[model samples]
Every structure is written in structure tokens, then in C-alpha cells.
Target: MPALKINVHFGGGAELLFDKIKKREVELPAVDKYLPECEKKGWTIRELLVWIKENLLRERPELFLQGESVRPGILVLINDTDWELYGELDYELQPSDTITFISTLHGG
Candidate 1:
């Protein structure tokens, strides 16, 4: 299987949780890309969130995750579109796609 390369970005205080790194280009393993549990669902943002927690998050993960998704007040964008428009967590990932996480929870 070929590797799936994609870009991930964090902003709006989300970077604080990722060691202040805002952009990352990662190549996710193609084999069993979505079967971390049991069912065969292609890689989605939901799974990607878990993957990020395990692989990318550097600190204060609780600030980024709530349950299986991003905490409330955070916005997620996939391929320049709102994730909610594309089924939110169920949106299957594609090669070279760009995923962005921006936290709306902030203080002045």
C-alpha cells in the first residue's frame, strides 16, 4: 500500500498544545489505516484526532480533545472546508489533504 501524505495545521491556541508547532506534513501508514478498533472505516478526522493525540500532541492534550473529538469551541477544517459540512468526524481522509485545527476557546 502507498503512504498517504497530508498536511496538518494548528492555530488559535491549538499550537500551544502541540509544542507551538503550527504546521506538519505527515505520511500516515496506508495499511489498516482505519481499523485501529475493529470495523473497516477508512481514515477519518475522528480517527485522525486519536492519531494526533497519540503521535503529535506534545502537552496539555486535554485542551485539544474532549471525548472522541475536539473540545467545544474548536473548529476543524478539512481541505479548506468545514468538517461539519463533510460529515464531521466521518469524513474520510485523502492523500495530500490539508487538515486544520483552530481553537475558538481563548482569552483576551
Candidate 2:
């Protein structure tokens, strides 16, 4: 299966954790269409974070991740909307989704 493509934006110093690159278009890699959430739901935010850490993260992961979730104070938005309004890490990914991460801990 082809990788799932999505847009990622980092802001509020979150870009610093990603080598200062603020925007990225990433193909979530896998031979199978990753559907970790109830099969048809496709990749969840939880899985995406793991993918980001292993593939996109450039520096200290501690600043971006805490256990399995994004560290506290880091806000996650899916398609310009808050993840909390959805199901957070359990939220399934859709094609062409725009996921953004903003670090409240930086430049506050």
C-alpha cells in the first residue's frame, strides 16, 4: 500500500525541535494502509506521533513527547481545529489532513 500523505506545521518554537523547518508534507510509510483504529478508521493520531518521532523529529524528543502523547503544553490541531475537540490521539487520520503542533512552552 502507498503511504498516507499529510501536512504538518510546527509553530511557537515547536519548529526548533524539528530542525527549524516549520512545514512538512509527510507520507506516513508502511506497506499496508495503516488502520490502527478499528480497521476502516485508518491511522490514529497516536500512530502518527510515533511516526513523527521516528521519522520527522530531529532533536530531543523529550520536548515533543511525553510517554506516547505530545508533551503537556504542546497543542495539537487537526485541520486547523483542536484535537481535543475530536478524540485526540485516537482520532483517525484522513487524506490531506493538516496537522499542526504549537508549543505553548516556547516564547510565551
Model number with the top TM-score: 1
lDDT by residue (1-108, candidate 1, tens digit) is 456788999998899988899999987776374454536435778778888998899898788899999999889999879988999988888888999999999787
Which pairs, if any, clash in model 2? none
Instruction: Tell me the whole-model lDDT of each prediction, alpha carbons only.
Output: 0.84, 0.86
Clashing pairs in 1: none
Q: Which segments of candidate 2 are over 4 A away from where they belong? A: 31-41
Worst 10 residues of 2 by lDDT: 31-40
What's model 2's TM-score? Answer: 0.86
Q: How well does model 2 score by local distance difference test?
A: 0.86
Q: Runs in model 1 with CA error above 4 Å?
A: 31-37
Alpha-carbon TM-score of each model against the true structure:
0.89, 0.86
Summarize candidate 2's per-residue lDDT along 9-61 as a digit string, tens digits: 99999999898999989887652455434344367799889888988899999
Q: In candidate 1, where is summed lDDT lowest over 10 consecutive residues? A: 33-42
Predicted structure 1, TM vs. truth: 0.89
